[model samples]
Target: MSDEQDIQARAARGWRLWLVFLLLVLIGLAISGKMLTLNMQEQAFLKRQGDARILRTAVIPAHRGVISDRNGQPLSVSAPVSTVWMNPQEFDLQNASIDRLASLLGSDRAALLSKVSRFRAKQFLYLKRQMTPAQAVQIEALDIPGVYVDREYKRFYPAAEVATHLVGFTNVDGKGQEGVELAFDDWLQGVPGKKLVMRDLLGRTVKHIRELEPMSQGQDLQLSIDLRLQYLAYRELKAAVQAHKADSAAMVVLDAHTGEVLAMVNQPSYNPNDRSNLGAGMESLRNRAVTDTFEPGSTMKPLTVAAALMSGKYQLDSVIDTSPGYIRVKGKTIRDHRNYGELDIGRIITKSSNVGVTKLALSMHEDAVRNTMQNVGLGQVPGTGFPGEQAGVLPYHAKNRLVERATMSYGYGLAVTPLQLAQAYIPFATGGLTRPVSLLKLERPEPATRVMPEAIANQVLRMMETVTQQGGTGRRAAIEGYQVAGKTGTAHKVGSSGYEDDKYVAVFAGVAPVENPEIIAVVMVDNPKGQEYYGGEVAAPVFSRVVGGALRMLNVAPDNWKPATQVVMQ
Candidate 1:
């Protein structure tokens, strides 16, 4: 602190001053850094809170459409229901929750515990798919935690077993699986929706943020099934199946002018309400009127006779001698049920003699017959705008075995479905024009193809009318009021081993109001094991009752009047 000390002291004092300034600066910097750190922490906390409150989304299911009949009577519909869902992670299987949940859900406690344990990782699981409002209310009263319900859809078929086959049914996922449900699934399914929402810590949807996508409900559909006629057909078919002890029975009724299907039914039917009894036989699933194939028997003879009349080969009154009840065709004998010594074309159809058809078939060229059959909607499935339809079997026109031709002439070689027979008969019903059958009720009329000459059609119609009269093969097929023109067919059903003797396929196909035939009905019973086996005995009587009911219901006045009874004893 003296001279060197004085200079040093001044310097030391200055140095001390500088040290103080540096200390002050350091203190200021520390204070500034602390404030910055505090501010940064506050900003981070504010951002975290905002992130927690932001919403993302939620999904909403769309509603399904309905299916109704022509008159707007619902056949199938979507029913609103509530479903209870559970989140495995949130569900408490122990404590007070277990007993409460078990009682609320009507589940055994042990089973519920086991089932819940299996869904440990699932954020969401269905406790029940469809629950009634009362059930939901009962469940809510239990105050069970971790359980919630959302609105859902379930299919309902009101007609039940009556219209099951054609209407089909939907599956658990609300998707159409079969029948009309499958066929029109594209138009019947709905689009799902998504929503942005804020969820609570407990995973409950709290606040809606933003809707992500749009959703649309499905459109309703209208089908062309006549419920009244359907019931009648079902009754007739079911009665036939029961009376004949038939393995299966089916029927189809077509409007000759419009070609609309008035009635279609099958026996051994199941209710759509319960698929538990149904199997994958594919046979029961089939609409036999439009599916399975079988020998048409003598019902096919009328086509040959029409073809003959059309080609000018024979007249309605033309004479053909049938001797010894049999006719030889290329070394094969074609025999009728009863022998007729001499007969005309009318008697040939009246008696349904195989020999008479064999003679006519021999007289005609094979090409003409083949072309004629094809023209009559044979060798092709009638396009009825439905799936799983069968085309049926048409034999080779020129069979190596001449017996084949004879058999075909008598409907033994050729095979077809009941639907095909109905369509084929349309030509005769509609005065030589063939038309497509419809399952839709529309104001627009269906277009028809010219299948035969009008003259031939009239002549054939006249001859067939005789077949339902006093001594005709289908004598039992006579309805009370209307003049009915039809043919009876009795054929052996072929089994895996061989032809079953007791099993027969009996059928009656014809048109009513014979002068201006309106309805074309084809009734078929398969593998009837009962005593009455002939088409005349089994199928004809069924046809009579069905056609009679149909005519009465339709208010069709009979050209002549009498009940179609076998033995009406008073």
Candidate 2:
């Protein structure tokens, strides 16, 4: 037990104590590091859950507007359809889910899978569209995950092709494609509603919330077309076209008082319910009444005669030397189908002589003839609401008088739509007052504008009546028991380069029941290829059929028994 031995033992004990303190410190550091790592992992896991889950935005499509006739008969309307939508991320592929969903939705699993795969990254996906209400109900009842039902609207034409030209149809996106639909698309399509919904990690819809104001539907429209008259017009036009074995035809019936289009039909029209049946051609969708322009031919004779008499330029009995069938003007030869020499004004109209009209045009200078034609509603665009309404092109009064005026008198150099001609004749039918035609259904007051004196218009009407009677050019248009006033047209069809010789557009325009005109119908036939290509042969019969059928439908009584006209002096 020496002092040195005691010091050695104490130092050894100090070394042991130092080692124990170091071990304790090392143990404490290990525990702190482990706790930090666990906290970091917990925070990361919560962050991941938040990122994976999201609130999806749901779209609510706007419903389209309705179109109805004056009597509230539905011309066009939208029906509720079910659309199946999917969030590809949510479609958990299960045997029962796939089978049940496919059977209910009438879709193949492969197609559904393909669509979902392509759209998975996208927030919204459409599975199927335009399903009927019953089908929609069946699909919604499936109640499968990721499968949801949305209400959509599909255009329905209850009248089918009856009002095809006026009502038109909408496109796949529910936007109007033509006719009134296209013209009023903005007003017909309203704002859509939108919603924000929260989803679970499995992509299940969990919460729905309103993120903005509620949406509204489009305003309904009322059209001016009378459904009954529309049916009659279509029926008659179809019958005439079928009987004639013609390519295409157009007809229009205007209310004599209001100028509202009571009926407008384009034959060989397509059914809006079946868009597949139609090709995207000018023929399929063209509104012929407003779009197609043709030489008015004999139908224009009344305009010239009326202008002649109205201007105090010529008397009804004034004789013009139209004998031997030709008038030489400015070097151009105006000839006719027959040699009508020394014809009076009445005989000139009755025979529809080209030479007679040329002389009449010459008698009244070029500017006078052009002005009269313009006053009759040619060379102007119809102010109807529909788009694509053509402003019929009238020939410019050429520096060459003979060629221009002669052609103008016979409707050779000018082009006009059937609708334009129909509107133009309104003044003659209603004592020389014209009103704008309407397509809207709401009641519009009949506003008449004085374009000519009532007396002159009456004289013109009487002349037109002669045109339809036994001796006139439009004799074929005479209704058996009715007093009809109309004119026939036989004009060459215009080609790309110029007027084609063989091609023709034949037309007839007139009013029925001479005592009191009720319906004004205009019929046009295109490219009738026959030996006799006159308007009397091609268009007069059509006018007779359409006018007759429409008159019967309107309950218009015939004026034959009443004997309104004078007997022939011969």
What lDDT, from 0 to 1, does candidate 1 have?
Answer: 0.81
Tell me, by TM-score, which candidate is best.
Answer: 1
Q: RMSD of each candidate?
A: 6.9, 7.3
Which 10-residue window of candidate 1 scores lowest in summed lDDT? 50-59
- Model 2, position 7: C-alpha lDDT score: 98
Error of 2 at 368 (Å): 1.3
Off by over 4 Å in 1: 1-58, 103-106, 140-145, 196-211, 279-283, 561-570
lDDT of all predictions, in order shown? 0.81, 0.79
Error of 1 at 151 (Å): 1.7
lDDT of 2 by residue, 1-570 (tens): 899999999999999999999899988899888778767767687666664567666667777778888788988788888777776766776646676677666778887677677887776677778888798677666666677776778899998887877788898678989898889888888788887777655444578866655667887888877888788778877876676666788988887878888788887788889878687674767878888888888777777777777667798779988777876776667788878788887777788888888878777756766777788679998788787899888877754556777778878778889899998888878888887877775366556778788888887787788888877888888887899988888887778988788888888899887778877888898876556567787788878876787788778887886556888888
